[model samples]
Target: MSHIKDVTGGTPIVLESLWKTYANFVAVSGIDLSVGAGRFCTVLGPSGSGKTTTLMMIAGFVAPTRGRILVSGRDIAALPPQKRNLGVVFQNYALFPHLTVFDNVAFPLIMRRVPQAEIAQRVERMLETVELAGLGGRYPRELSGGQQQRVALARALVFEPRVLLMDEPLGALDKKLRSSLQIELKALQRRLDVTVIYVTHDQEEALTMADQIVVMQGGRIEQNGTPEDLYDRPATAFVAGFMGDTNLVRGVVMAADKDGTLRIDHPTGRRIIARASGFQAGDHVAASLRPECLSIESPDGPEEPENAWDGRIAAVTYLGDAIRYHVAVGENRPTLAETLVVKAARRGTEHRRFSEGDAVRVRWSRSDARVLPPTRADARILPPMQAGGH
Candidate 1:
């Protein structure tokens, strides 16, 4: 049997071309990844997209149909879950119902036959670390959801395992509670320098907590990078759309200049200049621009010398922090523009200004746009922007 500590000093874990199939159906397909010691890695995807399956395989709950799993440099494909010495925190905060918070945090040490006095000292220190030093005697039923989660976390860390795996551990809490815990958890992980593999379907959670993100779809890795890398420079169309709100425009490449500039001819025959590289003439392409990248203007004046398009305002929405304007440019296509609410309010009264059917111009910087290859069959259009009611 392979040992977990063999790979813990530098390389914490490695999955070599991992594959998991259930009968004839594949759950995880050909995944290769490495988690270095003290790094925070997140596996992000929607449900049944193989993120959970991948986590289970690493934890030894689901045996792989192919490939080997190594903890450090030694192969542990056949090791049992208990033998691997890993800590896991689940979505439900699986603390023993009858045990007090202190006992729950101390259970792992007790199971390994540690002395009672040492367990007490360790448990007390862990409680302080989680800011629950005085709540150790309260049972799971008595503590709030957040408090119980902290106890669960303390339990996982008290064992001093080589790796920590969490499967949507904050999925059950309210938004406010979840956000607070996200910050706490991230700080704790960095302080302890633990190798963490977190699984979640929530994009915000992954972006908030992970040092590196691995996006999965259909049992395969779609993309992997730092949060900024994925957000600012998505390598694929799916990555761009999935990461956040983006405006995608389809056009034919009119020119591929030497300075990574692309001149595209939209379907309406309007030309737009954008930033891109590595494309041939006559190639079909798509450009992704964030809503905040576009600025709006009245159409009556002489046209502003900008990358501007004329469109009719389809709708206006006031989202406390910002105003979202949906501009109808052509048949069945609308571009969204957003501005700070403070700026919109300074312009004029809400009801009298910028109503639907008003002609307007949408302008954006060429540098704010990214040109990419046209999306494949699986690419999905962004959700329509919700207008704030007047």
Candidate 2:
């Protein structure tokens, strides 16, 4: 779309029982995934999670130990990377330093033995489409990081491949530029209607850009669904912890009330009620409460919330649009992470701002909390892996 020319738009992809193993350990287990035509899908996980390995397999950079990759319903297990006819954009913007931008983008066409006249026309049009109309003569070393990335993108898509595979292509840029390019890339993909399978360890990036997210851990798929589904109804404690900021309170189911209300007893004896199903009395479960769902019960007040706790602010973090309060409940021990984190938006409102050290009442509705299967009491959030690629 825009100035970009569309070629036979897209194709579907399927991975059946995909597995990859080295001498000692397995990288990708028997995982199955399907991506619809023209859709954008992201594989998300922590370090050593196998997202990158999976992408490499699909791109034919790495071979699957035993499995089949189907592109548009045909088995491509025997195809080489070039024979697969897919576009790939890497994190390093792998452009040749010796060649000019135009020649770099024309490399794929030259390899295919396309005529020189057609290559010139296609390279010019692709450059114009990517907003690099007048910089064709410049070398990769002379351009900015963003420009080099655009060149890489142009080169990948110049031959009009069947599908696109991006491996954290924006990870090298700074935050502000990366954010801007995320929007730009998604818009471009939509206009071109190309099926995209992206690999990244950044959860926020996945949430922002993907139509579907496949969460993986230890070489297995934990959950795969729309972003809203994964956020609102995570099926596992790891999914809840990895998707966003959540306070996972481990407890035991005490009883099942009318409707879906579940009565639970916290480890420290704090009672909890949640709307859930498929859980009977005496089931050990963890309750997930999002930071945004909690608030300070203002005195000028609505009716008392369904769940309330008295705690003093233990710490405060100043986020631009919101404030995070770490409140230590009086009944629970500090060493146990019984501290609840509350997020309050800076609305410049008439009510009031809750400050640190304030003895405040924290509250949330029963519907705001979700009951999950039991998990370890001290599972930390997935830390960003900086040194190695996932």
Candidate 3:
């Protein structure tokens, strides 16, 4: 197992116009990606977005209709699953029910016909690495979900494969356990320096674990970058809304101010000033503002903000550490229908001051808002409100 550590660092993976097509459906489109050696990269997307399919193609479990999968600059698209030397951990654990934990982790070595003595030694080391040294005799059914997941991970990692592929391996665990495992799994990857191509729809998991994130949608890449790059300055409306809680306000560019800010006219006659790129008067756009950017002020406040608006407190949702105020603005719109969400964190002994039906000012800094092109995802008059704290 000491020698295994030296061999397990990683290998660079490249997908050259990779695609998977079945009759009329294209599961994965032409995707070109370069995953660096020893990097933890997560393929993130919703169901049917081709993220899992791309992962399968990389593992050689699914044959690509076109293009090549390369490892260490060598094409492996035609290689069989066993010859690819890529380890996989599925969501189901995929352990042999009849085998003990030691045997499960040793299965790959056995298949490769490594000496029995070597297999036993390596299995013990891997079990200890995964913090399961004393549970080698336990069967799959006898272990708890988290333990079983660790067993599955141990099995995949024990082979010292060049690349590790995991497909929602912690999906079945409870929330708290899943979070715990996410940390442990990331720590393990760092210690081993393994190249990991993980697939998940969980944005938080992707953000927490991956050094790089590739966001997929409709069989094509929507965006790829470090977590902060994607979250702070998303290039599209979908990315803006999907990555976090944001207000999407549709408007037409009325004019560009001398300071490089654009004046946008909303349908409800509200004018918004925000920073944007590549647009002119008469162009329609959507402005994205994070809830935390907005602040609630009393109606009688001396000086209203530049972007302040008069609104009535519609509803208040209590979060453990913060409160979400749904403030209704614009005439003729229902209280909850066209509301602005303002989130305020609570300091010790601080209490909410406004109640429903109270007049208030919902305002945010002009710099806090970002303007993006109108997207199909925001076809609704007002984009759907996602659950907060993404």
After superposition, which runs of candidate 1 have C-alpha atoms over 4 Å from their true positions?
Answer: 1-11, 131-135, 138-148, 301-306, 331-353, 374-390
Q: For each predicted model, how many residue pairs clash, with residues at least 3 apart or on different chains?
A: 2, 0, 0
C-alpha positional error of residue 220 in candidate 1 after TM-score superposition, expressed in Å: 1.0
Q: Is candidate 1 or candidate 3 better by lDDT?
A: 3
Error of 1 at 361 (Å): 1.0
Worst 10 residues of 3 by lDDT: 376-385
What is candidate 3's lDDT per residue for 1-390, written digit by digit as tens? Answer: 011122344688888777677776778877788888888999887788887789888887888877777787778866898898988998864789999999999999999999999999999999987779999999999998888988999999887886899999888788987887788878878777778999987888888898998888778787888999788887777778788788888789999866678999887888788877788899888888889999998978575546887889889988979999988887777644368899988879878878899999988888888898875451112212354311
lDDT of each: 0.77, 0.83, 0.82
* Whole-model alpha-carbon lDDT for candidate 2: 0.83
Residue range 1-390, candidate 1, lDDT tens digits? 333453435347878778787766778877788777778898887677788889888888888877778877778877888788888887664799989999999999998999999999999998997779999888999988777877888999897876899988887778987888789888877776778999887888888898889988778887888999888887776778788777777789988889877788887767678877788789988777777777777887887654687787777887665677777877454433221111233244444357788877888889977877764443222222356311
Model 2 TM-score relative to the real fold: 0.86
Candidate 3: C-alpha RMSD after superposition: 7.5
Residue-level error in angstroms, candidate 3, position 216: 1.1
Please report the TM-score between candidate 1 and the true structure: 0.83
Model 2 alpha-carbon miss at residue 170, Å:
0.4
Candidate 1 worst ten-residue window by lDDT: 337-346
